[model samples]
Target chain A: MGNTKKNDRRDFLSKFGTAFIAGAALSPLISNASELLETENNVTEIKNFKGSFEDLLGGDYTNIKLRMQDDVRRALKKPMKDRKWAMAIDLRKCVGCNACTVACIAENALPPGVVYRPVIKEEIGTYPNVSKINLPKPCMQCDEPPCVDVCPVEATWKREDGIVVIDYEACIGCRYCMTACPYEHRMFDFGEKYSDGLPLVANYDKRPSFEYGKEWDREDRHSSPIGNVRKCTFCAHRLDEGLLPQCLTTCIGGANYFGDLNDEDSVIAKLVSRLNVFRLKEEMGTEPNVYYIR
Target chain B: MKKIFYILWGIAFILGCIGVAQRFMYGHELANYGNRVVWGLWVAMYIYFIGLSAGAFLLSSLVYVFKIKMFEKVGKLALITALVTLLCALLSIWFDLGHMWRAYEVITRPNLPHSMMAWMIWLYSAYFLLLVLETLYAFRIESGKYDGDKLKSYQKKLGILATIGIPLAIAFHGGVGALFGVVAANPMWHSALTPIFFLVGAIASGSALFTLIFAFFWDNKKGEYYQNMLKTLAKIVLVAVLFDVLLEWAELSIALWMGSPEHTAGFRAMLFGQYWYVFWIFHLLFGVVIPVWILATKKNGIAIGWASLLVAFTFIGVRLNIVVPGLIGEKIPGEASAYIQPRLTYNYFPSMMEWLVGIFIVAFGIGLFYLGNKYFKLTKENNSVKS
Candidate 1:
């Protein structure tokens, strides 16, 4: 029985080879037919899903997180002066899911009353004809930050990479910076807790946030950040590690985009070129790094 | 009457101690001022007291620099009041700081040319020293420490000191106004008129307070000299009140006329929002209307004293109006409803703790004033040194 089966397979292969050669010599259509037939035969060897390997290798994947991660890695290769980090948010793609806000809270270990990002919802027109817009606000990180100049202690400043950062240690928590910020992005850490009324505070609740590449324990009442004016840093710690910002990665609808604006080939640079792009309170002359695509 | 005042002081002092304990333990957790309205009752109180100090000191210049004899008896009292109020203003603001210990940073490592607050700090320090020196010089003459030629020389020294103090006082108080005025983000405070208005308000409030103190506590109130002093003080306050009202009207009418919502929002809020009564009731009714009526209608020291007291006490409402309205709105069109977190909203009213702390600072100032008045021989009649 084994000898007969081997002879039968050899006969089938010889016939298939003759047909494949004839199809390739005949026309493009026939050549495509032969290729599809061969692919079908290759699929028979797998007992599960077809085209899984081609789907991986075929370059059809368009995951924003992966694209942004690659963009960040490329950005890391450039010097700080050459890397103008910026963010572009597409309002049309935003579903107001607030995933970015939650992700930021988790990534920064933000306490209650201290939010780095908030999605503002507004209803346009009247009742039946109304439409809604969700605007997610973060720190503008202005080029000419009013908050920077108004700081009596020089606790906060603009970085070379265009991110406005606060030195929690030096901040007097006067909230003058808070008042100076037209966007009202700076928040005072009122030393509140998310687990205030709980039976016992969880260990995760006490986890120190690693902001500016330094671990900060909030348990000590006399510590720095507790009395400091706090705001978003655009996930600077993660960027230092060649990773995308938590908000960008956790964006549910891929509405948030971040990359080096200095890079001519970056996604943010491309989006910012569009006519629909704008910044909040542009008249105030803050010259914000964050842009929006309506 | 003295017993009643002492009783009131004791009650407030005890209540203030409780608030102080809460403040140290909780650290602004009990205060109603949030991230949006970062300043509240204490901040308003600071500017109020500072204005009072500036006004009183400026009025004292009338006696020292201008050599106005009608105001001579109250010059020492005004100086002492200025010092006491200045200390209270500093204390109120100090407690408002998140890290009260780091206040020295503003002095030690300040962004000098950039921050109005830094300039205010330096100017106030100079003003403080000048005030102490001026008070000592005036006390030297009043206490009969020097005779004839020496006395005249000490008076000359006071005149010189007061001359220097006039500009310093204006700079420091105007610096306070400029502190808020420099913030271009808040359109209500960004006006060039803000500092000018503060100077006028300080004069009005300070002169009103000086009038009250002189009328009620000047030791000799039944004489022709007393009546003349009271008459002159009332006239100064009346002129100041009228000038302050004119400036306030100009500020409001111009802003309202501009038709820009950003410019008018704060003014409108002051006039018609939830706390409209703060402007119309507390400030206009008690601070302006009643005082204006009494000063205009009556000519007696007792009437002017009570009316001046009303204006001086109710000016806190005016200060609050200046502060809260500038901060009580959304930056963006819908920013007010954007977030639902504690202190992230526009609605702000001082919590009980804030009120207690504010009351405590005032009570503390009153106690200091009482002690200073009783023991320092600050009054004209008590100017003699103990043998």
Candidate 2:
């Protein structure tokens, strides 16, 4: 249903854009005809009246008409906000299954030796009286992001809807962002591929944004120049279609919660208020958007 | 003479090309680096070369601004060295950048308020311009054709410019050091003294590089002016080395006294862990200690020249110690600090392509230097007033 709405919007934008251009091209002809009509009526005094030429034309001057139409088109084409995308990981409910990590790899079709998410195991106390804890780690998506600061080319930036994004095309693989990230979230695109299971999958053709919406394309995936850095974008492709992140959806123990903190009424926000939520490296003042409830 | 130089240049060019090819093909995996040790030899080399440039430029200021007759013979050479080393430093960073093409965008659309890297871009560009203008002025004076009126006016203008440049040179290198030091998350590098340490190291290494290069150029022909220039430069090098050592000791002692586990871990990594040999043996013993001893004890001209060579080589080691050890440990282990040993066992052997490109840059710098010297008559005879 959401896809149909988006398609309708896209269609409206395409037609509007075409009409705006056509209107701009025909404005002079319309003005000339109006002038001819005025001359035929012997209305020479109309030319001397002091008002904008646009007002004189009395219909629509092409530039302003096109501009208004373009604005409408842009508004229609703006990305939908149905999925106020969020993630919740309940540490108390988690088991050390490592299922989410495996799921993320499978879903993302990650390159060999690259794991987008990893489960970290920590043991506390002496050997005899020790308790083990499993923590699933993903990109923190910090509010005051350090990675964005040190990106020399401004390739990585924060989106208005509160997600950090990597413009892979613009990133010059300097990895300064990797160095700056205290969370150790960023990864270098070494142009590695997984060719073992399905050799042809390694050669999967990449489609443009219109086709696959920045998911996976053989030509465009890591082809963003090898030296550029990359990190998780909270599954923007899935989020666009009102779906939860793969890790969040596939968690075996249901440990993660994803939602909008901005909405006071959101379930995640209510849960966060009730539980003692924490973020990693809070002392660094990065103010990560991801919250953890122990 | 030109043929021999060209042949040597060609060889260096071929080797650098191979190194670059390997770097591109293997994705810096060929270099001795990993997640834990993200920075390695290239970063060290970058800092080292920048330090050398700053040092040489500072020394040139002595001749140009302070009117130091004893160091006049090598002023133009120092300027040329400054230019070349800066180029080399820039190239090192270029190869280090994962996305080399988007480097320009760093300038066009810079992130302000919180970006140290952005500041570095602006600072480096300004510093490069200052060096170019100062060097041009130095060349003009090196030409004997400078009439009395022009000579006085040029010196006055250059002296004023050099005064401003000295602080800028200090800041450029110090700023680079602070780039790493300001990252509070990196317990190894975050320090108030990091900028000061960088400045001292730049001066020390710069002096060492100049002493070595000056001696080599001097060997081509002997002159009283050249001898005096060497003695003065040797003295400057001695002072710089002592200050550098003192700062290093102070920095290390403070780190030990603070006794933070992470800080201690970083220091120990340098003193005894993976980087011990490079830090203790090459950086301390060869770079600082032996050179200090040689400079103090050596009386013969030949001995001093050899000491200068040792100093130059050891300074390279010092740069490695500064860059590598700080980046070897992890704030968060296992997850954060992935093992990043260079694919090649020795950690680094710049592939043939890398060497070829590196040497080509060097050759270009040398060619410029030679032209500057030949056309401008950059000899002490050209520097004198008839009165």
Candidate 3:
């Protein structure tokens, strides 16, 4: 009886998908019409993506951030499980300004020594032959994330949207995950603020930054994140609100790109499609979502 | 002499309390581990103490499982040492965790099977329970209430428990090695031989601990039987020490032969880096060579005790060598120098708070052992040896 019911449900779902796809394919001219129209979210995305002819090209549109914001809006139309968030950084455009680093700290309200994204600037070759190279390192958010595997308490895991998130409440703060991450991406929050060793901490030091769509208040000294392992979530909270990651928008060099890899039209999907783009420690077989066009 | 030891222990206990206080008040801010070298003094100490527990337990198994008559007297004492050292190991690691309060989550919401660390916690919890049960039965058998048949049955029961514990001890301590070994990202620890190396090291250090305690503190050490027992332990320690060194050489040689910098970087840093003395002077000379030479040749009980102490204590240098050097080198090229903050740098040395807390833990363990010995009269053997 159970098998018959399961088979029926599976058959119905497949049949329904087949009919809808077949009907959608018939309208070759209207192919670009919203697959997202099935959900209310997809309808809202069209409004966000479309504008007047001049308005489309205007509004301080210096670079890819504006274009990527539309891609984010489109991706947000789909259910989170269907969306695979990714990032691509063009090394040629990066000037090693450390703007992304500062922006990340400011956005996350990160305490001293807790950094999510650090732009590693290296000057290759001897002094006369020296040339600079910049690499903005974030949590690789690996398909096979070593960090998730080592977490004893099941405190951290990769979400369906390709973001690895930590349940601060559940974390025993062993920092085993920190050791396991090949890229050295995870940071232990020692509960230190910028206002540490001062007479009184400033108000900003106590303010919470929303991560994973939940406010993480550092006001209480012995609370969750204060003594927890923290890492980049690709601005998961901001993604829910159809905004690009803080580092992407604040990037002075316009070197960073963000979008959904699940969608063929998304910016990151197109960027990473190029053969020149590569991932960090590809030999480690982490299958990192973030790629670099070096 | 005892008065001097007590005074120093008292001083260490006081300092330890202060260290615990600072740990609670400041969190990991006072710790020097940072992002690069995530595991530091406490982690090394935890592994060291656990190794001691595993070693002692295995030694006790010789009396119960293998039915060795020579080590029968120290069976209760061995079980007690294993229990106390296990407690110290747990406490050391508990202090290391970010949220010590949430340690229960490891049992409640563990990432089982996949995580070697989770396996370690589960394995040790079983080991801890087994140790407690075996110690209780040893106490029962020691009470001298039962006649020959009942006593034999109890010994049989103990034999079964110790038999069960042999693999449990090996699995957990070997699992600890496998925990580091499984992290393929760190080439230094990612080896098939790591688990075997750990088991051998545990035997070497744990047997040395048993020998040290038996040689110096046992009540009937002046007796010919007691002296013979110490001599046997010296031989066991000699064999174990040699076996452990052989495995170490195999590990080092294979990594060097591989010729990958990622594999060799940790070894290079350990042998020739800033703290070369930790490996060469402390581990090689004091931990291995001096101890090995004395254990092999010395018949004097005092000399054996000193040798055992050197192996047991300087094994921390070995533990430190195992942990810190693996993390000293950068994963990405130019990554260490990429960021300039003190926390971001590759260099690490434990802070004052860390050292104080470490002293406190060892002092605390000694305090417990002292109490346990006094309460249980662990020095008194079940069957008195005729001099």
DockQ of each: 0.50, 0.21, 0.55
lDDT of 2 at B346: 18
User: In terms of DockQ, which candidate is strongest?
Assistant: 3
Q: Compute each candidate's TM-score over C-alphas.
A: 0.89, 0.79, 0.90
lDDT tens digits, residues A62-147, model 1?
34355567778998998887788899887865767788889998999888888899888998998656557888998888888999
lDDT per residue as tens, model 2, B274-374: 65887778878887778788888765556666677777667877777666666655555455423222221213334444444556555655666666556
Query: lDDT of each structure?
Result: 0.83, 0.65, 0.85
Ranking by DockQ: 3, 1, 2
**Which consecutive 10 residues in model 1 chain A have the weakest lDDT in total?**
A45-54
lDDT of 3 by residue, A1-294 (tens): 122234553344334334334443443655433332333442233234322212322443323456679889998888889999999997865767788889888888888888999888887888655556889998888999999989898989999898999998898889888878889999988888777778999888998978778889998778878889898999888988999999987665556888999988666777788877999999999999999986
In CAPRI terms, model 2 is classed as: incorrect
> Per-prediction count of colliding residue pairs?
0, 41, 0
Runs in model 1 lying further than 4 Å from the true structure: A1-61, B147-157, B382-387
In model 1, state the lDDT of residue A5. 30
Residue clash pairs of candidate 1: none
Worst 10 residues of 1 chain B by lDDT: B378-387
What would the per-residue lDDT of candidate 1 be over residues B284-316, giving only the tens digit for each residue? 998888899999989988899999999899999
